[model samples]
Target: MACTLLRRLACLALLALAGCTHSDFRPDYPRVASTVLPVPADAPLAAYATRVTAGHGSDSGLRLISDSNDALLARIALANRAVHSLDLQYYMFHSDATGGLLAQRLLAAADRGVRVRLLLDDLHVAGKDKLLRVLDGHRNIEIRLFNPFLERNASMWGMGKQFAGDFSRLNRRMHNKAMIADGAMAVVGGRNIGDEYFDASEGVNFRDLDVLTVGPVVAQIGQMFDRYWNSEQSYPIGAFHHDTPGPEKLEELRKDMDAHARQFSQGSYAHSLVARVGDLAHEVPGTEWAWGPTTYLADDPDKSNPQADSAGLNMAPQIRAWMDGAQHRLTLISPYFVPGPKGVAYLQGMRERGVAVDVLTNSLASTDAGNVYVAYASYRVALLKSGVQLFELKPDAGRGRHGSHFFGSSSGGNSLHAKAIVVDEEHAFVGSMNLDPRSVHLNTEDGVIVDSHALAQALLAIFADATKPNHAYQVLLDDKDRVYWQGKEPGQPMVRYDTAPQTSWWRRFKVNAGGLLPIESLL
Candidate 1:
């Protein structure tokens, strides 16, 4: 199968180079025997299920995973302790160190007779079909992809073909990320399975946030997983390949994974896992928990379709409810923020009602997505003029932490990737939903709205530290309604930049040039 896929990819590449293409490029991949199993209620995690639910009524016991090490450790701990099933979903899951280690753990769990389910977005799954098929050969493990490309072998060229032949279907993607263990505990937020998400990447560290919850709310998360798993958009790994690994090859794959795990055992990540083994019992029932009701909000799987009638069930409407009901203040943190006219008007209306609106997003220098940044830049003036406080993240914001060797350090750069909102510091929202139109109207998003002021205050504190002058640039409108970035270094004089602070000349030119393009809606 791998050889076959390589041949097809070569053919597609040749065709692409030759400017020869087919209009009917729809892929009719093979399907394998599969079944969507029910989430079991009884598991080892049920022992502490009461602990996480105790005294909180219907609210879940939540802990903020702000540190990358703790975030990775928490997932490892849950995977190790899960006795019944593991349902993992994400938009991006790299085949790097962290992702490989997680796969090793999942394989070990399956060996222990635990059911493992992995669902990932198809956009990033190109060139990984063989690895997925090998994993899917395991009896207890199943791998599926959401809105996958039929041409799985040709990563870039396949995407290009789809873009031209089927733009409407290819444009929408699944951006949700979550990991569930034993149907009792789950982690949901902006972090995907990759080195960058865990601050282990070499070039850039994403300052992200997630919530670890174990309670009744986890059931809803499990249900959300099941819905997407059963949706038509999801396809089993076998659906992409006609051949499956036999027993001998499957054994070889397992041995390879085992060797990889043994190699990782000598690393710091493995040491963290060793220290936190069996710690899930102690992690819950905390006195720090704020007792109140909570709501798990998610968009229907059909929300990916522009014409899908998701109606009030979409995350945008639910999030808007929180934004609309804010009586005093709102703090929004999205890495890719492109507030169109409607968003600007919403914030302005809140300001007119005497509400404070503060926003934090990636700056041009710190942004990894320049096209999205251009769209966001077009709205900065409007947002500022309407009394919206704006702050752009500093590329070097996490340097202190990197130097201290505390938080996970990326290669010499950092950017904000947390998607959260604190409304009046009374209610908090944390999840995969960004404030961009892609998240609001196209991608399926999931988040938990906690009716707890403590959580809100914690998120607010993160926002406060992140918005410091050294970590972020405060955007202000001059008397002439011109834009300028104001920032102050530690124990240094205040400085201002007429252009984006610390941006290169070419980046500035591209941003200015991109602003002229009518791409805000697609951003």
Candidate 2:
């Protein structure tokens, strides 16, 4: 009891100190306005997109990218094929191998005279200023940070202090992710620019999803990008950094990035990715593309403003409408599944109406965010009682794949990072928005909703494979209402775990402890 009091006192002291600290940074810079570059008539990507989406009227061509290597390769391929412009917006862009490789590709594209606009959320850019400045130094490349911190070089504690001082502003984030090439084709999904997201991580890799699209949808996505790009929240890197890096510095960084890319290419994973390059043509062939009516859904950039009336700017209502309109079945795949009271009530209502709802989310062992799992766990019994079928991805789910899953076969751990919903196996929604309060209210998110039976079935097929006993645990309740996990491995016997399977006591303790806190809404 004394220890608890001491810790509380310490926290209070820290908060007091944070309250005393004032931000020295301001957003009073000359904001230069720019929009998405128009695609030239003879642009290669424009020609390809036009040829593929011809005679379809306003319908868009869509292809799902379930494999991690292919997702990275597709972005690189898009960059390579881009003739006019490349617009990239992401929540996080790491400086790891996959990020460096993509950065190298973007640099090469910029050298080819393609205008590159890279907009990233500022939450994760603390130690990446030099690299971002160097990228911004490029003649044809520009970078912006959204909802950035006032303190540029803040340490962990400093960041905490800043957040404590300005909780309302710092709490909000931009969670959108997209890559539009030549204003013709775009890759929009849950992935950011990172090795783990691309299945290149040696540790935990994300099992995510993305869709490559062309036609009218790309134009809509470009408009969405423009909305955020020119918003008051997005500030150019030059706004913070007055002194630009010299050409010599840029050349040095270029050589370093190129060397890193060369080294990364020498690896066996790179070879495998390169070997499958030809497979992309088969996947994205004009005839094979799924033609559909697609809607681009995004939250307004003003959602981040503390005083802004942003309720009408949310995408949650549209998503809820999609789910509410489900007549027969609904399948949801979210890594961080924290469905609060309203969500639970809504799902229960759907089940009451005889809708078959299946949800695939991260298990305690496989989840990166334990607090989210705890919050989600609170509703599991309620969800199960309401006839909502639940499945949790196993930590080793990626082991079965030879070299295809988002995380490589050799990865020590794997986690589900895909956020998707299929309604009645006829409509599909894929994007960065998760079914959590943070995504619904706190963060700015975007995605594509395609009214295509084929696309819905394709996404469902991926979900079906992932929910197999070997890859995931089918959650169930006993006669006594106690929850248990049912799972089976390939050629192995079925087993049941009364507690969270494959998890440590320490991990479980942390989750339980986290639940005692009043932070479920924040999860």
Candidate 3:
């Protein structure tokens, strides 16, 4: 790929740092084979904004497409179909089956003379940049790294390391996963470039979701890329990537990718991806995409984001604003739910009013991030005491561990990775911003304040229609004068628990202990 002079300079800077040959580390890219899929003729977010040309012509074209399972792959395939350009930005890009499949698709797109640009965070490049370099050097592809730390520079592991660490910038990370194709359509949401993220889960897959748009929002997605691309903060991988061994090493990687892809092709996740693909694209026609209002936005380290705040965006204040502003109901879904005292108070206050509140989070045994689950476990009493509707997904649920469903069971593997809020179902906010402290106070989050009745309703409709069981549990005082609980779903009757937590002794210890740790500030 023809890199810019600025990119060349960055390459040189990285080259001056330390690295070795690429044959040393196993690449993270996985693979997934071909499959059928459904397609959605969803409208872009910008279509509803002010118009200059009227209809789709006046709009900015398709800006984003969000989906879990097959829906995500279908959108990616659409981008792969683009002959002109492809731009990708993400925090992590694994070398797994799904990852390799996407890579193959991108390479195929590149073969069509498309301009391919990839920007990835440096945090994950450790011992793996060489394989990426081989691809980055492709005639039609260019890659860059953001906020990298040169690992080989340390003479030993002590003073040199400390000195280099001081000089290097590694505190912040780029967590956005964005894709823009041909400058006509874009996808801006929470999925990173990985197999589990894109539905290669044989055991289970992330129950993640994203938003897609076709309209002027394309400009926003592209603009975000343009800004980050040209920013000094981004470093080119050319110089940073060390040399690779002979074709033997390359062949080994290729073999692993192929095998992984074969595995996923037979997995349930691949089937789901195929189905969603067909659903979203088979019937759409004309210059205009399906119609609805959507917003494309980007959140960096800004004064408004909690990560940028000096004292941090305390859960109390931010939630109070969101809750105090709520006119009807607030529904929050976070895989990892940790509501501090302020969150409890805010939700309680909302309950005191006429507002209805509901919360969805992973069960203790089901959560992949155990620490966060612990924090959430500790807050159970606080939430139940305040009269909030609480739902805990069963460990065996499809959207449980690893975000995938039971292999042969009628389960949904995709977990609730959505960081969203439905306020009266009239307006919603969907983005990488979780309700947890890390999102509100420590991590850089981004989302748009969507003001569209149709879109909000549609999203709520999805939340409602999906038979994804929501087990509601209410805290109770038993006749024995001890606290207990009952769990109920839509069709099933209530199941009682001897203890209010419905958890094991070990699980309780883990969560409560995690709650008492000093690292609550970090997710």
Candidate 4:
């Protein structure tokens, strides 16, 4: 009976694909070309950045934003401080509390004559056309969608049909995340614009990392943004929709968003955040900024094309070079880690060279992507054999605490979302690129490498806090070569689990069954 139902569903899917014409996919749309606006010499942001880096030639200033609320505040502060322009690129931007608050600020900036260019990947913007159209209706704001779907249907069946028709093109995604303010400073890291990323979600929240940078590297980031902004893949949001929302509709959206912001500000969670905005407005001048040589790296936009020479456009090699240069110690923090054979060999080689290697990733119970955990599990024994120290974040890692000095506190389940590498405690890399197949071969990624002992130490401090026994489990191999986990919670005795702890049997079965499939390359 199940097989017959499957057959009927397959037939329906085939018919649906057959019914779709070329117009059902991405259609030819007119897009106007634009470049980054030049930085006005007297702009306040530029002047501030200049004063801070007066003596540091060819070096950038860096500060790590490990707290979720601070991360959101950083972006909001940047948007509010912009006097000339703002360029933002991200994989996902939802319309939740944090997203709406930032959106309201972006609109406020636009109202002040800030040229706002928002570039978002189309995968997550299916039902938000009304909001986007209204924002695009503003003369000072121009929105673009990267690699959009013209059909604008987000249902399960619709996505399946689209995938059946154009699997290769639709599978490729732009995974880069960046926000540049007035061509003077930028923030780059693993965060997306959403409530969970900012600790405002009632459910699961992500512990992420971002670096606010200024000086020479900002120009490099601007150049990279321009390359993507002018690429053939970017389409003006107006091109996808035929009609623009009228002024009345824009005003309606404005009032609704304003009301939401006002209501949110009065809430307990946002009250403290609102109070901190003034300090953030001045870019936190009292905070010590690390000055160092920084190198910005990004995969070319053409990497979104499956037929493109991905190897030549890849940024993984540059990251590998940084890893290859590690001498004393190396640490990796990734949410979804599916290191293939080459990565295993590289880490083993580092171990052989007497470099202590440590890795922190999500455990099965803490991970949002079970398929990825399945693939990552396949190489655990090999990685252990290579003498790589492994730690898996606990599901409730950040619960029951106020904001710590390093990682911020959360009320619900916590998942690792920060992607970074620290080498010899003197250099660090932070950005959206995960150490997995999807980040390497499928999606375009970007990051910055800062050669600063202070920055590296700060990142190492975060790793230290996140990998404590209370916050994470140390993966180990018994004398019989069996995998086990060991950890202890605050005021509790040590515990051991032969299987993934804090997870149900059904979840374990699903992940183990998924491991049997030959889908590692697509992970």
Candidate 5:
């Protein structure tokens, strides 16, 4: 998602001002990084690999990581246990506490002779090139950015000018997120590296989900990472910099990273991870396994800049096939849902054929993306009238049953970020793809389709909890054909709203006004 509207305007002003002062500055575009080091396929994850392979036959071992703390802990464990290599990719890797802690771990892994490759989208790479370049100097570590901006050293205005001239090329982004360790295990989901994603943020925390998998799926994920790592869009950090870091600076960076990791390891968070991975490490018995066939789906990296003649390589068509096979019901959990006319008509047909369709998305008050809510609100009545059950997640969701531990806790607000689909209680999908136009038409996306009844039940249970009265407000129209929000409060009568009751009047006004803009496709 782009920055908040207000922030974007602020940035635009800064860029405009900078262009006046530094119009002559120009930066060089770098060459691609070296190819990924060969994977030692025979090197198994010490204690974890045997259990995933033995007794499971060709089936993959799948486990869900719903808790923010646990999800981060799983990543730390996988990194700590990786033997041969680690390939980590993300759209955002903030230099906050979480990012710093993981950076420390990755550096240590590299120091120990493990090859580590980090690929990130260029949208968030502004102002961080120097720091990343220092890390790239490490012998065993390499850093690359995807589709970087050309005027790397330009002032804000210079950037704005460059963006203006190259809007279409710079607008498309790589929104894929995944982490593979030692070719033996992988974690894929809706998370980016930040304190908010791992329950450490005091502000807005996300209710996100990720899956840890082993077996044949890991190999497929490795291949997907290679495709992007070696793609034309990726460029080495060394290419943008004048030269690699000198010895003194590299030593200082290493020392700072060591101190950060030492401090993090002494904290309760690291202690908890140390305990869980040990307990969770073992062979997953057949009875406990969610055994089934799995298909990994990913849009071609070049799909970000779609060409009419490009091979038909997209995740949408593959996803449509799964939807087509839904025999009973369809459940969707998308944070930024803009099911346009065609999507609505398709769902209507499904309902007509006796299929139950349910959707869970963010309420105007809960959503972090205001413009997106505007676009989605325009389709509310149409979706409801077409027999689609709709629920908007409460800002205070994850407060019942599971509480903060279920979703990451925050004092400011809570919003849905997970993108998943459940079809007919037989299959489930987990990934970074939202059901918005941006995901389908502009950005590169990826996901996994698991044909496991057990996993399906787990996801359905989560959906049930999320849609409960205390967790969400049902969107409905009264007898007078007026749209209102409805939910019951504990020890009180049910409540209703002419508008989103949790949001302030000003916020609602801003969102409604944004609906008038001609940017539904962008949202």
Candidate 6:
């Protein structure tokens, strides 16, 4: 009898514990039917890059940059003007000056009835006060959050509450950074909205790149935003305050974020880009920009191959395939590179086939995601021994300054944020895809595969700046197998070293350490 009573008591306690929690994906909202974005039937993925071109960088229409300060500001300004209907999406839109200021410009544009759509990842919005309310209320503005975790009022659930609750599911992140305006011009590539991206970071800013285009391509990107906007993946802010009722004052509060577009000096970063945009659009040569025709290739769960939806046309496989079959030299610039065994074997085979392969990634010191660093490190030896030319960004890139793009310095303006590949002086791939497992298995990212001689030549010019002696660390293992870095100048002797903390050895340890954890695919 005593044992029975004690067992019953323990069972009751367990039931009580289970009753107290709720699921991360709440049920307050209706169970919306899932649907993937339907790709336009008229435009297939094979239309783009059907033809090829080279030596087009001399056309004088391309703008290139190796730094993030005034140059970036120019690009941003042009980006802002390019948008007649702006769709800005990013993971981190900080509340700092850079974010605040960009918000101001965007809000100002919305006020002009330009039809602005802002989709921010919900991680930072959970407890951010007045900010969300004000933005949500904008007249012509629509803001949505992706994959939100809402806490229940304990008002509902039928045994579904028995599951452990999770409010912070950090594994799934929306890492796409794109801006589209006017339906004809789009800026797509690697950039998040923050001080770091805008060069407002006095100590450092991301060494990032974005391409501005005025073509049918912008319409394709616009369709992508429409899918995410209407998907079950995104939720509106009005739904967050369910029973408490959304306040009517959200409208008046919305006007406050638009206080600074005019404050930017005429020649400042934001202003000049706006001026150049007119020129860029005017210079759009309508006579066959692509060798054949252009098509937008995007990821969708429904149409993917293998499972027809599992990996969804990942850029890694696409880029890897391109590298595997390339006839000449292939250069890689992926800040977060993680080539598993197969990726290694594939690259090795390519090298053995006589394709000159070179790679540029953040030195262990400069990476912010240490966990990813470790995953990448596991393949480091495989890459070096494969006879593939391996190079890491020096701690100090951009003219020997600690805060330059030569190294992926978090404090120095240059972080190896470019996700690009140049092949044999013939073609190039630029977009938001980073070469990593997490990016491969998860996340919905987009980028354009341009096979234009002009575009490829333009990309090559930028690559020239990125690989200069002062900006990049040429990884030289020398015949003795001793690891050394060559940079600082053209004729400088190589400096021997094991690893670096100048970028942060701690971060590398953390990344490699994270490799020990069981949920690597989750990372």
Candidate 1 whole-model C-alpha lDDT, 0 to 1? 0.79
Per-candidate total of colliding backbone pairs: 2, 0, 59, 0, 4, 27
Kindly list the per-residue Cα lDDT of model 4 for residues 1-523, writing each as its tens digit. 9999999998788777946723433356667788889887889998898788887888898888888888998899899889999999999998989999999999999989999999998888754567988999999999888877766777876566677777777788899999999999899999999989988888889989989999999999999999999997888888766666899998898899899989998997787676654234364552478879999999999988877776679999999988889999999999999999989999999999999999999999899999999899888999999899999999888633542433455577888899999999999999999999999998889999999999998898888888888989999999988999999989999999999989999999999998898988887
Tens digits of per-residue lDDT for model 2 on 1-523? 9999999998898779677665434457567889988778678788878788879999998888888888888899998888789999999999989999999999999998999999999999954588888888899999999998877755777688788777899899999999998988999999999988887888888989999999899989999999999998998887776576999888998899889988998998899887875334232567788889999999999999888998688988988887788999999999999899989999999999999999999999999999999999999999999999999999998545443344455556889999999999999999999889899889999999999988898898888888889889999999999999999988999999999999988989988998999998777
Q: What is the lDDT of candidate 6?
A: 0.59
Instruction: For candidate 1, write residues 106-192 as lDDT tens digits.
Output: 888998988999999888886576777788889899998887766655656656766655567768889888888887788998899
Q: Cα lDDT for residue 149, model 5?
A: 72
lDDT (C-alpha, whole model) for all candidates: 0.79, 0.88, 0.58, 0.87, 0.80, 0.59
Task: Name the TM-score of candidate 3.
Answer: 0.73
lDDT of 6 at 359: 83
Tens-digit lDDT string for candidate 6 (1-523): 9999999997787677566754444346443322222233222121221111233332212223334443345334544553246677777788776677667667667667556677776656654625655665666666777755464232334223332343124345567776765554456777777777756666656667666554455567777777767765677665565432244554444444444434544435555445543333233343534331233445552221123346434555665666555787787778888877877987898888888888878766566666766777667666888787766665456454433342332345456777877777666666667877666766667766655566666566666666765666666666776655666655676455556535556655666667898665645
The alpha-carbon RMSD values of the candidates against the true structure, listed in the order shown, are: 6.2, 2.6, 10.6, 2.9, 4.9, 7.7
Off by over 4 Å in 2: 1-16, 19-28, 278-284, 399-408
Model 5, position 98: C-alpha lDDT score: 80
Top candidate (lDDT): 2
Ranked by lDDT, the better of candidates 1 and 6 is: 1
315-397, model 3: which lDDT tens digit per residue?
Answer: 33443454467888887767778888877887888889868888766665456776887677667766776678776555444
lDDT of 5 at 417: 90
What CA RMSD would candidate 6 show? 7.7
What TM-score, over all chains together, does every model reach? Answer: 0.90, 0.95, 0.73, 0.95, 0.90, 0.75
